[model samples]
Target chain A: MTGQFPDDLPAGQPEQSATHPLPAYVPPPGDSPPPDPRTAYAPTALIDLSIPRRTHPASPVVLAARIVPAVYLGMLLPLGGLWEDIGLIPAFGAAIATILIALVAAGFGWWSWKKLTYYLDADGDLRVDSGIFQRQARRLQLSRLQSVDAVSPLIARLLGFVEVRIEVAGAGDSRAVLRYLTKSQAEDLRTTILAKAEQRTKSEDATSADVDGGEYDPAAPPNPANLANQMDGELLARVPMGRLLGSLLLRTTTVTLFILTVLFILFTIRTQGVASLAVAVVTGGVPLFAIISEFFTYSNFTLSRTRDGLRLRNGLLQTQTRTVPVGRIQAVEIVAPLLWRRFGWVRVQLTVAGVGGEGQETGRAVLLPVAPRDEALAIIEQVMPGVAVDDLPWVSAPRRARWREPFQWPFLAWAATDQVIATRTGRITRRISFAPHARNQSVRVMQGPWQRALRLATVAFDVAPGPVSLSALQVDLPTARGLADAQADRARLARLHQA
Target chain B: MTSHVHEVDAAFAPPQENWVRVSPKLITARRITLVLGSLLEVAVIVALWLIPGIPTWIAIAATAVFVAVFVWAWWLIGRRVRSYGYAERETDLLVVSGILIRRLVIVPYGRMQMVDLTAGPIDRWLGIATVQLHTAAATTDAAIPGLPPDDAAALRDRLAARGEERSAGM
Candidate 1:
């Protein structure tokens, strides 16, 4: 256990020497153009300069995959009894019509695939052109790109194609999405874009005079952090099947589903002379399906460290590879459900910005969906480098906190490091939350009638554009007020340093 | 049994005594709005009473309850207006208000994403405006109402400038 993270962490930190050895902070050459921090896109080694680049179209199999949903809808419409009033002959005719409709949908899918093309422009913006009839083109500046994710569904994986999504900050809902590229091509493209983004940030840092740059050339040296080379790749955590299943089965959702299934079986036995197999099948099948779906979604989960931030890859049926930049994560939350506490397992989630796009589940927020307590803590330490979660000093809740929230008081505690404010709460599903001081938008101290009577208060630290359930709950009134005031000051100082 | 990680810092300094009160015209603004609101309530009740099938006593009782609430609210509005006070600190701004549930919000200037000065029709008529400070986190308590229009603008500019200065490191 070397506590130091990898060498790819952003510059200007004194802790770099403790980690892997890299070049000291070097200033950019004076003669170079003053880099505009906003549009400082510099190409990394990932982009193959020798190769002649042209617009690439998506794989042809994507058309068949895209029309699957429409085919299912068509099949379900007939079963829904849409033609019940009409004769059986008419119903038969409707079924044939549905098949023709499915064919037409497939044709459109083919046309869409043909129309969608992506290529990098001279200005370094990734230009995407799409639309079968109406032309739609979007230019996503590389410097503004926040994240690049590669996802492969079961069908795509089988066909060896992957979908790449590039999220651009301030672009609103119009992020560039290149779908169904060859698996290798998608991987290569993702690395190139991420490397370019990192290079852009380095140039911005140098020109903004934020970093103590000397002669920092991003292209120089055998920089293992180079994205295309992937020389500095280090596996941080891996969730085992046993632990994943244990955490999944012990979840509140699974427990409630199991209880409902038993109740349904009991009701069926009482109402019918014989046990109704239909009720048993219907009630039991849902939870089973949900468990299987969860298993498929998070199986083979792995978290790795890259030069940019963290890289996560998981899923059995639909594998997804996502990169979360160091600055993008606003907060971190670790939850331990009632059953999970016994086994010492926890689920780690993060509050990230600009990644939750249309048609994407915010589930991308989970950094480590399920891991052991020690591993979870380790992941926290690595993701939030320089903040030691293990040795943090907590301000324990008042002794009478138990009288108020009996089962939870023991676990209720909060602490503040130089960079983050951390709080732990809950009884059944214990949650430990950490909010970076620079990212926190405001601090509030609240007192209800009962709490006021008890001279107690709760303090909530809110972050922008993310659901932050991070709070120091049920503390002495004066303590809550004191923390709120001090944290406000601390946050201000951190923001000043950030600027 | 206790392991001391680090000594706690000095206790937080309480808000300064030099708290500036909001404009007194806030009471007039509240009075106008409350009177008009109560009138609307009365109109609704009278309409209900005029219905043929409904008993007159039900509407009369509702009107009585409304009257009692209006009087209580009218008195509370004055106190609420008087309670509003704010203070500027070295790095942050403190806003204090509320009578029953005493509220105190401390928003650092650097954290403010935007500072807005708004004057509604009634507020404009009274020659006053409200200054709102917004952060990435939505904190509704960060508004200071009943400032003179010029004062509100000055406050907004000062806060915005401070926000920019503090956000440079960010």
Candidate 2:
């Protein structure tokens, strides 16, 4: 790594040219020098900023392990055809070429891993520089950092390595990943980064408060009492393995598959045949895959709240630990599928700012995959203090709106408290979404031709790009307009109060 | 019809109808594009007609339908352009548009992330530009097109200043 830096560095500093163990590159003017590598590179260093560091040496091996299987799968059929069409010599040559390609890929991975370096700059912005041929540098502002996730895939976990993914605000391209770090190193890095990010936000708030004569500070830390539960973090909720599996079995897909299988079995018995049962078995694959994937993704799911933010840990095969700052959660949603409702079970999800938008990794956005309604509500209360879904003054959609959505119109309702705006929609799979007024980006009232004819409109409270879509559909036009205006007013007031 | 229009306006009307309407030149610019697109379609139909195995009646029917659709769109363009309106409130901006599916979006100044001013070739030729207001939410599609360049610039500056003053971190 030291040798590679000099080749890229501009020619200068002849005095330090003779086999200097560290790169001789100078820090930017007025900025502090990089920390000593010996101290900074220590595994136990808490806040190792301003020092370029490489991931574990096993990064290349892990990358190759991930890639070789894909290469083999892609080349297998073509190589097989070559073996049958041509004789043994050409087949052997193709096989050799494939091996050489895989070897070259492994070598490239090693080179890229060697070149990749990440560090925190003087401004506390996380910078990652990677790519062997075309160097790609990404700078993520710590102040805008949303979440830091440490994920370990099955192979990487077996190899005792973790990947750190940093999610920042704005576009999808703002995300940065540092792959294949030792598990301990990744955890320390996450803790240090989250702490530093919180520190930066607090300092910025302090300065802004000074400018405003210490007026309301929206970014002020949440309840100090809550802060008392820091460091170790209080485990808010943990789903037992049995409950998780039970929830998976109770899902609509599994229930529907069970029903179909039973019906197919009865039909097969009547016909004295087993051939059509194969159709049911084949159709079962869809729900089977869902169950297995969901089981692995959500098994042993646990949520805890620490000083830095909310922490989530889950996954059996590929474990992930994500830390989302309290301020980053734009909206929270509670979904109760038709089947789960009978068991009083609900799934809690969050729309986090700076995370991936629609169709993001469901595991990351999920707060609780399956929990009793009361348990989920308890966690929600902890996450968003003082806002109770049941206590809000709910108003259902007007009866006239039923023409637009006959069944769902009854479920379409909205409530606005001083702190948050909540919308409940859907009939079969009920969903209620809560978004703080301060977090709402905008509000919209829309009317289609049919809706206009019925004097009805849909009011949507727009939060950051995430899965939690908070909207009240098919309300009276006046009510929709009023909601939009009032929500905007409340959002503005909330922002001012918070500020 | 007038009462229906009034009812529709009442649903999303600004406090006192202080909406700043876009330049009427928008209709002309849009009409130009419409005519150009129709001409291209006509050319394609004519080419098909000249092809060895195609029938003349098919081309004629295609041209007739295309003309009818173009005429409908051309007629609707004026109302659509006229429908575009925006109101600058004390703390938020309200943009109302769409003739058939009317929409009114209220974007708080504090939530605004960017205000973009863009002008296409035809719009520039017409001396008009578009001002797009972006909030943290990507779903907030608030764009006021066919504004005079000076108005667009003025709006952009005002929105940006307000956004800075009322900066609400996401």
Candidate 3:
């Protein structure tokens, strides 16, 4: 691990971790283990428990497990006349080639693991340096650290090792990953990092308050923001197995497949033909894949709020844990599909910077797969304090706008406050999206000829990663203009003096 | 026509008329480029007609359609260029364009991440440049084209200064 530094460090300087031996950062308030006296005596950086250095050994056995899949595919592929012509010698040669390829892959994996290393720097930043040839180093400021999670694959679980993923604020695609740490090391690192981040934010917030003459708003609640900042992995929402299964079966794909199957059967009986076999197979395959996808996505969903931000963990075969920093979330959305609405359940999703999965791993954008409506609302309140979905004065489209959406526009409405602009749209599914004013990238008011004849206009608020625009169609033009001006002013003020 | 008793006001009417229109010279510039592009299409089709055993009528129809489109486009070129306008508001910049599918984009000064000035060969020949304002969202259409070089430079500087001051607060 020390050998991989290459040119990033000077020649004579010893490892920073060995010299500092970790400091005495304070432990978090509740449910944290009592400080162990062994490392707690540091008095400088280890206010919390100190994590001892542990490296994931380069074990070749883990990659050797891949031979099973390789052998299965080798047998599955050589099925035609090529097998009949091949004698025992050629067959044996193919098997040897597969084994050789698997061995090479396992060797590469082991060598790569040998190069990865992570340690706490003297400045309390978690420094991770990995890469066999490129040798990249990442230093995450403990204060800017958001959340850390311990994940275990099937093999890793069997080996009693867990991978730790560290999420930081404002860094795009730069999350630190330390793979195959012992479970205790992963857990200890997560707690210490989160606890130290919580402590730093509290002190920073206090200092800013002092800088502003300590004039706290009398009307506001007594430090809800600070309270939210101090959370230590409180469970916010958990989806029940029954609701997950129910939501999976209740999707529109099921109905579409049923209808298509019925039509194919009817046509086959009438014409005594099998030409529709391809159609039937293709139509039937879609719903089956959807069911399998939902099962894997929402099997054991759990959402929690911690000092780091909102934490979401779900998936059955390959679980993923994502933490989005509180400040980095551009918008929040509560969506209730038509079928899910019958059971009074809604899914809460967020558009967060870095974690919205612009390209890869799209499941990270979802905060909750399926939860009771009240629970989803509660989780929103937990993440975004002061902004309540029910308290805002929602203004619906005017009565004249009935010509456009006979039933939906009456339910569609938009509301804005100093903190957030919330829009409620859709009739059957019913979605309410909330975006903070400071995060708004742009806004537009558009009027078409038909809409102009009715004095209706649409106002769109362009927030990154989320494009749920709010439209008050068929309202008087003056009212639309006034609302646009007011929203522009409010958004400008929010951006000018960010809190 | 039967119902002048509508209770609503005209929503399509913009609030103000202090909009800055594109440079009138842009019309001549675009016409020259359009004619060149049309001629290129005609050449490609006539080349295909030169091949033996190919239908001569096909090339004739293609050439005829290209000339017709060129003439029609030349007629509407002035109104299309005149429709492009932009306004600098107190907190946001409003850009309006298009004749059929009218679009209005309002970009708040604080949200601007970059202000770029670009001039193509034709635009430089016409002594005009285009200013593009890019925000965090990639989907934003916030460019104002066909401005005099001096005016474009002034606008870019002002937008850059305002962007700096506003982003500092964030």
Which consecutive 10 residues in model 2 chain A have the weakest lDDT in total?
A1-10
The clash number for model 3 is 12
Give lDDT per model, in order: 0.69, 0.76, 0.66
**Consecutive 10-residue window with the lowest summed lDDT within model 1 chain A:** A14-23
Q: Which ranges in model 1 have alpha carbons more than 4 Å from their true place?
A: A1-58, A65-114, A144-151, A160-225, A229-232, A271-293, A356-364, A402-407, B1-14, B47-60
Across A225-295, the per-residue lDDT of candidate 1 in tens digits comes to: 34332312467888888878877788887787778778877887778644555766766787788888888
Estimate how well candidate 1 is docked, as a DockQ score: 0.34
lDDT of 1 by residue, B1-170 (tens): 02211111111224775578899899999999999877888888888788888888888899899989998998999999987888888788888777666666788887787898999999999999999998876543599999999999998898999888877644
- Expressed as tens digits, the lDDT of each residue in A1-499 for candidate 3 is 0011111112221222222223333445696556544333223332233343435563444545535465646754664335446644545556666677768877776777777666667766677767778888877765555556677767667777777777665444447777667766665566566555555555556655422112222233223223223333456688888888887777655866868977997887898899886677778777878888988877788876543456677888667766665666777788887888888888777776666222232122788878888877766765666677888788878877777667777777788987888788877778898878876777666766676566566777777745344444444555765676677777777776662
* DockQ, candidate no. 2: 0.40
RMSD value for candidate 2? 11.8
Question: What's the distance in Å from true for residue A233, model 3?
Answer: 1.6
Please state the interface RMSD for every predicted structure, separated by commas.
Answer: 6.7, 2.9, 3.9
The best candidate in terms of lDDT: 2
